[model samples]
Target: MVTLVYLSVIILAWFATAANADIQVVCANKSVSITWEISADLVPYAARLFLGSCMPSHLNLLPSGKGEVQFNYGFENCKFKKQIKGKQMSYQNEITFRPYPKSKPAAFVYPIKCVYRSPANLNNQFLNPGSVSEGRGSLVFHMALLNEQLTGLATTNVIPLGSFMPIWAQVEQKSHQPLLLLMEECVAAHTPQLHSGSWVYPIINNKGCLLESKQGNSIFLPRYHSSALILYLQSFRLGHEGEVYIHCKLTAWDPDVLDESNKVCHYVKETERWSLLDDPFQSSICNCCDSTCKSRSKRQAEQESRGLRHNFVLGPLIVVEPDSPAK
Candidate 1:
């Protein structure tokens, strides 16, 4: 009887271990990957497992009769939902398994989440309220060419013509009332410094209108916050070679107030109209985009003086023809 009891205990331990599922996850800048391991006892049910309505990208059968499945998908794909809370951006999804088609509920369910820092929160100095006004009472500003994932700076300076380029601009507004950032005007030139006779290309004109949107797929993406903006520009080659520089006039304004002179407007080809990114209901203010955007009156300028405006340069980006040889 004592020998039989020892054998029964061992059998129970093995069953417990086999019943538990092992899961691992890897989060990349643009995609998320999950690996689910199925024990030998549950290998038959592998077909029923799923990650947020997506099937396994790869499946392997182990020598030990166990099975492994991987799910890979982009953050915006696979029905993943996104949420922005304060300085954090989070993506959420779930893993589930159904034993039968007629089942009332999933037999297994596991919640999963991926979180990233907001583009405006990437700088550590912005976290400190006192540091924003430490010197000259000027706010800190940043602009960079982001990678395809929009998570960090681009690793390469080379860009293919007609490809979408992500440009991020942000301002530190710590300890101050909420503010909005706008690209009043932007231009592309061959040199970082503008001279009297330098040739230029207009990207954004008429105060805050994005002229490129009317010609190409370039437009402003949904803002993560009022203090930051992202421009998705369709790349273009200048002079057939060399480096290109982008010069932009950035303005910080009151969030509660958006007028024709202090707004970001992009043309919507589908609607055939200019739409204000901040407040679409106020898009009527964007009608002047096709003609001439009026300058701010003296009283309006004085009211906006509480905020700040500055010029920022981003560049040295090399745009090459698509048929050119790889660098």
Candidate 2:
């Protein structure tokens, strides 16, 4: 009877210690720091603790017999994953520890994340005079093909055929009212200039719907802001060789108003239905994705008069097969 009571006491103490573990994270412009305070009972297993495949950089034993571990890494290190969502860039990693040496899975896991404002300037060297449209008292629009991190333009023009390509488009609202950016239509072409003889593949069509998403994993990611959008397109081979260019018609519209003509939609494979990325409640606007999506005559004229629409091109991207050598 005494042995059973002692065993219960030990079990309760272990649970209490595990519940007291705490973690804190600090994010900076280019680096991140994570500090974890481990309970005294778990200090013996500290060697097995990891933060996203990275062992703690510094560990200190406290007077209370507890352990404090610190993890310091740059934004690009420690296997930290980056995500852009609603004007914020989030860096995510996990704190995990295995209670036993042979454990196949982590016995304890705590997710840690830090968020910062998305960089204002992506520093795209590809932006040319033609890419910007600034009518007197009108919004300025910019578009570029972003790198995998969404931090800047792709460093290289070569991409694996099946890999995801990131395209970012944003609007500099200036003094104008809040506006949302939308890709009305996008196409992949063999040449920078579109001629009658050019080979073209449609991506986003039917006004603002992502057509490739119906057949592929391509889709519009969540917006960094109402004024900024990112499209993750699965690369495809365009005629086996040279550079592929992406041409898109971008539109800026009132954020409060979303119509069949001014919205972003993508097909979700799981639900087998088209979904609106910005506002799902009004996803009914996406039903037109299957058929013709006509623009409101009056709205079209207004957009044209206000110079709220423009065309942008991004590319020279080379798509190669899985085993092909990098260019």
Candidate 3:
């Protein structure tokens, strides 16, 4: 009877200790911050927590007698993967913290729910049947200019002329039904070179029509799969000046197929609208120029030469205690 009572006490103590260990995960910028608070009672037994595979890159542990510790892991180094949906980019990965040398039960493992949203001012279009689209499946389109240096950063509404602008277009299918698909892209003046799984054609039509490979329009997207087109172009035409409008149109069709029940016949026609300006595009900062471009440049140089520079040192300023020499 005494042994049974002692066993019950041990089981209860284990459960209590497990329940007290708390972990909190938060999205810090592009990285994830994982913090675990060890229960005071278990501090003596708690060792360093091991990340996945017990690799040195994932090892983060609390110092001796410390009750809490944090581990900040970059998205690339961690096991988590990134996903893109519409205008949002999210992380789909799990962080597992295991007790070193193995424990009675498993350690804490949880997924990090973090989403990075793109700017809301993108040129997005949703076409319905009879409007520009004729299909049972919902057709969606979006266009934006991505930063050359930082691919994840996007510029909206305006692009600079004469620059090799990187344009990103997204096409999503909301319906599960199979359908015959035809996709086409047309610029106002010169055709931009598209880079994707699909091909591009020189012939562009203002009226909505499916340009099949037989008919010369070679770009086609198969049904049931979403498509993303990365196009590049340098518009130096007559309308390449400041505040000039640049327009692009995308059209698709779903003609009647043999399998009527499996395929939903429809048509989609959408336009991606933006402007081409002479002012250079800058990500993470607003570009505000003076009335005259030449005047702004001259003033910018003068301000830089006369501006005061504040020399400052950035640091957390850590001090390490001296340890005794090992005998």
- Using TM-score as the measure, which candidate wins? 2
Overlapping backbone residue pairs in candidate 2 total: 1
Q: In terms of TM-score, how similar is model 2 to the real structure? A: 0.61
TM-score of each: 0.60, 0.61, 0.34
Q: What is the lDDT of residue 189 in candidate 1?
A: 95
lDDT, candidates in the order shown = 0.76, 0.76, 0.36
Per-residue accuracy of model 3 over 151-254 as CA lDDT, tens digit each: 44343323444444444444444562322222232433222332354232322221212222223212222111224333343423333223222244432223
Q: Sort by lDDT, best first: what order?
A: 2, 1, 3
Model 1, 235-302: lDDT tens digits are: 98777655789988887778777787888988877558787776665678999999988898897677
Candidate 2: misplaced stretches above 4 Å?
1-137
| lDDT tens digits by residue: candidate 2, 120-234 | 5542343455343344346677876677977666767788888999887887877887778889999999888998887799999988999999989997874556788889999
* 142 Cα displacement, candidate 2 (Å): 1.2
By summed lDDT, which 10 consecutive residues of candidate 3 come out lowest? 275-284
The candidate, 1 or 3, that scores higher on lDDT is: 1
